[model samples]
Target: MNNKLIRQAQEALIVLGYLSGTADGKFDKSTQDAVLRFRRAEGLKRTNIISQPLMPYFEAATLKKLQTNLKTLGYANGVTGKLDKATIAAIKTYQKNNKLRQSGEYSHVLLAKTNRAAREREQARNRRAPVSVQNNIGTSSRSNDVVISSRNIPSQSNSSKASAMPNLNNRTVQENEIMRSEPNTAIQGKMRILKGSNGQVTGCKISTITISSDWCTSGNNKEGSQCNVLYKNGRVLSVRCR
Candidate 1:
């Protein structure tokens, strides 16, 4: 099988919203989540393998998701899902980070970043051992490692928003963007703050990364987004939110 072709196919899934993770091309747990969600949404058997039968729908969805994210990050000037220069640039920047690749090609790094983006989200759920969640965390600015602690949940004394660290990526704050709070159910002294683009926790500045399980989340035009998390299944893959 042509790994390049397979990687391209996987990139289609990431761009179109069929999957949310690194486009690393290895098709790890996060990719599985996106596929299952797409399959379940399409009334097909949810399988791990991306086969020939499901290629068309997968491609369409991947393009859409890619367009959305690229646009959100100010990369895709075009609304269409076509891989224009703008979109490629956005993917390249993303590739440089979360996926952590030196090559410019859309090899495994892109696939991995798009797919594994949600894997780091477990930090929002698990409070006891914050390091547990960072194990598979990506290197994206937003993928900044979070350590959910029972003590860090939003409170009058700490909910000052500024009390939560600032997003040092120099990313302009969306004026209307509401800062989300970590769950109040955290245990005492458990670190429960979101990481920033600086790779440090300023205050619990919860960005969209807290929305899903990080790279574990997957999206598709048709099925929306899904996760690879074991959840109750004894697995730990997560999914991105749409």
Candidate 2:
């Protein structure tokens, strides 16, 4: 299958909670395993191969699509894309109401129904919404030109505070400015990107690879270098490195 198809499958699987990784258009083992799990859950013959007939199902149920459709169908609270506890609860409630199995799995049928229902709801909403004619070009009516819907606008009180939200770009710029502004120190440091089993960045390093839990210097590279693993969390676990 093409990378596009693989990416789509990965996206669908992710929303369905079968996979965890960015869909970077690669047919990796994680994507294959996700496909297998989905197939098994759906009572289809489980296989690593991305069969032709399964493409549509895989392309369905993307996180954004799921949130949009679920919200439109009144099954979800909002379109946050992330399937947190609230989202899972909403999915369960939807499944119960629809008389479908309450496995909380995002099936092809669920996705298809969601898309259709969301479309219908959008059409109905549009029909009910007020429309306005544009004022003449270069006219002074620009300030008054705006569209308002009759629908209730949800409050953002529950959302994160602006101050609490990280300004990533600003932080990066500030760091760069600081680095450039500061004099070079004698000490220097190097860092390596860490990957999960599926090769996605996990923001941590492999601590140990030996059969025993003891720390050893065996897995050093030819340059006589061993990784001094660091972690965001304090706990350490033994893991195999490829």
Deviating ranges (above 4 Å) for candidate 2: 1-61, 129-242
TM-score per prediction, in order, is: 0.30, 0.30
Looking at model 2, the pairs that clash are: none
Local accuracy of candidate 1 as per-residue lDDT tens digits, 1-242: 35665576667666546666556777667777777777887688867667776776665555655555443332333446566665666666665555455344443335445434433333433422121221222333444334232222212233335534333343322111111122322211211333346322222122232322122212321122321212211112332223
Candidate 2: lDDT over CA atoms? 0.46
TM-score of 2: 0.30
lDDT of each: 0.41, 0.46
Instruction: Report the lDDT tens digits of candidate 2 across residue range 115-217.
Output: 6766775565344311111111122233422222223322223353653323333321100000110112211122233333432222321212111112111
Model 1 misplaced regions, further than 4 Å: 1-53, 66-79, 98-109, 118-242
Name the top lDDT candidate.
2
- Cα displacement (Å) at residue 159, model 1: 18
